[model samples]
Target: MMKRLLLVAGAALMSGLVIAQEPVAPPQVDLEQQQALRDAVSGTSRGITNVMRDAYRNPERTLAFFGVTPQQTVIEIWPGGGWYTEILAPLLREDGKLIAAHFDPESEVAFFRRSRTEFEEKMAGAPDVYDKVELTTLNYDPQLPIAEPGSADRVLTFRNVHNWLSAGEDKAALVFEKFYAALKPGGMLGVVEHQARAGTSLEQMIDSGYVTQTKVRELAEAAGFQLVSVSPVNQNVQDSTDHPEGVWTLPPTLRLGDKDRARYLAIGESDRMTLLFVKPE
Candidate 1:
């Protein structure tokens, strides 16, 4: 009995020594930074609703899949109401840069004439956070100067591919080509948009403003981006893809009425594709 007790105590001491040698989790943004996010960004801005559930359901993993780190420069394309911006700016504050690329005021199809002031106001109060972020405005002219070549470490576009399909595939293609040119040789372009099925017809997608994974890959690859990997962390498997109004028929933008609310609610958010692409190193 005495020998057994000594062995047990020795084992316990060894376990404690092992644990003490283990590495600690990396340092992170403080409570004030997180509070700023909660105060400045609305639930709607994060696309939160009973329908669009993933933003709230899995935020850290979602941001992680975008290759977001505390050490890389990131550009958010057309940050509508600065939803991701609010979280991203503060999180990247200590060691990285956040560039909010807004549409030029002189251009048509600009969604953020008033968003500028709102974003600036939100950013203004957090000088330490905002100091790490830069606001860049550019016109979407195909013939003009935009982001410099090999400039950004990552370029992220969320839910804007549908607009490209509406504007015409060629128009979207040019923008993507520009996205390719704007990245460093090994930079990433992370895209999260409404996902049509694997076999959805391109013509139908163009009409309804939803694109298939294949279509997205095709466009990105054609523009010199190599398909890297895809994450289904944001996948919504409940959707049946038969909505009368396409993907928008499901949620916050539901164009349909009470007749289909239950049905769409059952479908939850539209299935989304989280694609990662990289230029050749």
Candidate 2:
């Protein structure tokens, strides 16, 4: 009995020693960096209307959840109207690189052409804030690549999944695969999209501009990404996923105009799912 007790004690000590030797994960974003990020989000250059959406978007918290730092190369997919671009460009200008992957300038579609022109004009208007931004083009074509393989530390897309689904399931899958190829091993893809009700059908997901969390996960997993985390930072519990004009019936878009505009305004923005996925190392 004495010998057995000594062996048990020795095993316990060795187990503890091994645990103590295990390396700890360093802090991804320190306190000082967090403060700086917040400051950038709240900066006056973002303009009053853009800043107003901060409460709903929770840009600082969302970026922090995605583990975004100023030093990492970030590719923002389809920065329509430069809403997030206003914050991202200034923050990453000094230490990091910001790549804006926008619609192809040669798009024959009138809306795409107009949007591309407007975005170029916006950047030109604010050269001080946007001059360093590297412009690239991304379209539905799988042959056209967005960024170099394994070159980006992070790939971010906001409210774009539904459009891809509208294009086609295969197209959506191809885009996610492209995102997978753009990131370094262990790098992350951050997605913020309008959230559909749980178990929503693919038809509704495409039509309503709101996608189910499960569907998004399935797509990412199929693209060889592991869903690491989901955040409620941009969630709006008030949205019931039954809007007549779809998610756009809500604020910012207000496609309904003054018809029950007050009601939609009360609900605020559409409920959003903020997800993080990682490429396996």
Compose the digit string of candidate 1's lDDT tens values, residues 3-103.
Answer: 99889888989888423322222223345544543443433323344224445335555666665666677888877666677667766677677888766
Please, what are the lDDT tens digits per residue for candidate 2 over residues 224-267? 88777788899999999899999999999999999999999999
lDDT of each: 0.71, 0.89
Instruction: At residue 28, give the lDDT of candidate 2.
Output: 68
Runs in model 2 lying further than 4 Å from the true structure: 1-27
